[model samples]
Target: MAAGCFYVSCLALGSLGSICLLFTAYWMHAWRGGFAWDKTLHMFNWHPVLMVAGMVVLYGAASLVYRLPQSWVGPKMPWKVLHAALHLAAFILTVLGLFAVFQYHNQQKIANLYSLHSWLGITTVFLFACQWCLGFSVFLLPWASEWLRALLKPFHVFFGASILSLAMASVISGINEKLIFSLKNSTHQYSTLPSEAVFANCTGMLVVVFGLAVLYILLASPWKRPELGILTDRQPLLHDKE
Candidate 1:
């Protein structure tokens, strides 16, 4: 029953994350116009699309690498590598997303990093980078002692989940900020609850739901990765081979 529930939760989490990505992409394409680097507003659209793809969806997926049951029988090194690689990719995309926004602001003569959304977004990225570096050094590197790894493990997991929370909050605020700015002057003002506004609101809600689902999966004791005594016993052999 526990295994079944874990799989079910994983499916739901994947679906929610995919939908959030799609909704963000659709909003940018259908209402805000398609993305392009030369076009400032369109370039701005890439900010949300890439951020949603990288920071929210991909980041959430990476955090679940160890919890998948199919990999329970094998050495965990591969999974660790995969998790780190995914995070590296996500971090790169997130940086590009930030660059797109900054470029847009520069082109438009708009002030940068001046909003609540920007504050949260930049902080999340900074912390996420730090988290990834620390995890890589302690977990993946060869020199770290078991005592140090165990000592840092709790903090690594804590910040992993916390960074996701911060990311979701940043995205939510960004959605609201975009909607307010985009709709304030047009015929379909924000006060009137325009179609774009409605779609964006739905997207934001989906993001929140997805974030909650990820947290639930991470926090559930039943779904946590089991310790691999076999692998631990083979550590000496593995190190000698390395």
Candidate 2:
């Protein structure tokens, strides 16, 4: 029963995250005029799309790898490698997303890093990069002391969850910022609830819900990965009898 519930939660998270990504992409392309990297307005569109895909969706999924029921009984090395690879991919895409926004801002002669969203984004990305490096060194390297890994594991998990929270905040703030900027002077103002504004609001809500679901999965004790050697071919996971 516990494993079944875990699978259901994972499915819910996957579906929500996918919808968030799709809604973000559609908002950018259909309403924001599509994406390009040619220093035009189109370039700004990539900022939201890539950030949602990389930081929120992929990062959330990567964080759950160890918790997968299949991972509980097997060697953990493969799961560790996969976790690191997913994080690396997320980092690359996040960097690209930052470039898209920064490039567009520079081309338009707008000051950078002046908004709450920008501040949260830059801080989250920097800390996320540091977190990944420290995790790789302490968790993945062969020479790392067992004591060191044990000491850092809690901090690693804490910071990972914290950074994800920051990402969610940044994305929601960015959505608000974009809507205000886009509709402040238009016939269909944000206050009037234009279709674009409504859709964007829905997208932001999706992101928030997705983030909460990921956090729930991360924190649920019954779903956590069992300790090394705790599970074997003949043994069952915690709560398995339920």
Candidate 3:
């Protein structure tokens, strides 16, 4: 029952995060002045959309893979494959997202990586890439010995969470920086919590919810899968009935 509840929670939170991120982007894109990064400035909108989808939403789901019950996620080999695939997808989207913003800055003749947010974001992406490569090489490949896999498992789990934490901080910093810069010329005061400001704040808060939910699920001890010794897809957690 606890496993079932946690699985349900993961589904609900993941859906909520994706919906909020998409809605926020839609609101910004449609309601506001619209998009154009090159000459028009639409490129700016892509940054938030991509990051929320790729990092916050997809990455969160990938991180929660280990926590998912066997009934939902299925056997070990496929589960591991799915986990890696999700991370790869998130990495691709994140790279594209980063490129979008940099392209916009270049087109505008503005300096890039000028803010604390950019520095952190760049660092996070770099670290995430390294982590993914190492995970794929060490865990997925038969190249790694059993002893090595055992030694590295905990580090892989914790470091993934640590990198996720850094990514969330970078995302928040990004939202704040973007909002401040965009609103700087507004006749409507941000201090007054105007429509746009309110939307931005709400979006940020939704992202925070997503991050917290993911971290909680990942850390919950009860959700961890039983270690498969020799049998690849066996569920040892479920006791055989007498």
Candidate 4:
């Protein structure tokens, strides 16, 4: 029950964070002028960061369901390591891509950076999908030799971690850009325009809430179990019925 609740909480928080981020981006674009589909799409250039982050929290939570004590089946050591690595990489690439998108304040820079960000972001997503598929297969049907599984784990974990870390940095960069914009335009007040800072603040709050929820689930879940040597080993205990 605790495990289920933890997974659900993480998923809920992740979904809310994604929604808030998207809505805030749309609102900012709308406030600037009438909506252009292209411009709106461009505004969502940083969306991959939120998407990857949400996925990480979600997948991480799901992992607990299968890996925790008392579960029907837990991932073998090799598979577990791979899973962790892939998630981390996804997070890093998404963050870096987002940063690249926000670094451009001018049209020319935006144009230039868009390609770079898109390619890197797409690559990250592809890698994540591959890793996820591999994980699912391994979990569902354990066919690989222990040695082979062990060999693959570290490579997978390292790349995934790299991606996620970079993706987070990208998110920070985007927020920074917004802050700079606010500072520059604070003196001029439009008749009906909402400040960019407001949108950024709301987004930040959502991220914080979601992050806390994820952390709570991680810490609350039962990852350890009491040691029982006989129970730990694969053996059936017989009950005496007279």
Best by lDDT: 2
TM-score of each: 0.92, 0.95, 0.89, 0.49
lDDT of each: 0.88, 0.90, 0.77, 0.48
Which of the two, 3 or 4, has more TM-score? 3
lDDT of 3 by residue, 1-242 (tens): 55456657967996888776786687568645556656436876787788878877889889887765553444577777889999999999898888888887788888988789989888889989988998999998778999999999998988888878887888788878877877778887667777877777777878888888888877766556666532233343343222
Count clashes in each candidate, considering only residues at least 3 apart in sequence or on different chains: 0, 0, 7, 19
- Candidate 2 local lDDT, 12-120, one digit each (tens): 8899999999999999888889977798889989999999999999999999998787787657888899999999999999999999989999999999999999999
lDDT of 1: 0.88
Better of 1 and 4 by TM-score: 1
Model 4 TM-score, all chains together:
0.49
Off by over 4 Å in 3: 35-39, 71-75, 229-242
lDDT of 1 by residue, 127-189 (tens): 999999998998998899999998999999999999999999999999999999888889888
| Candidate whose TM-score is highest | 2
Candidate 2, residue 84: Cα displacement in angstroms equals 0.4
Model 1: residues >4 Å from true position, as ranges?
228-242
Off by over 4 Å in 2: 231-242
Worst 10-residue lDDT window for candidate 1 reads 233-242
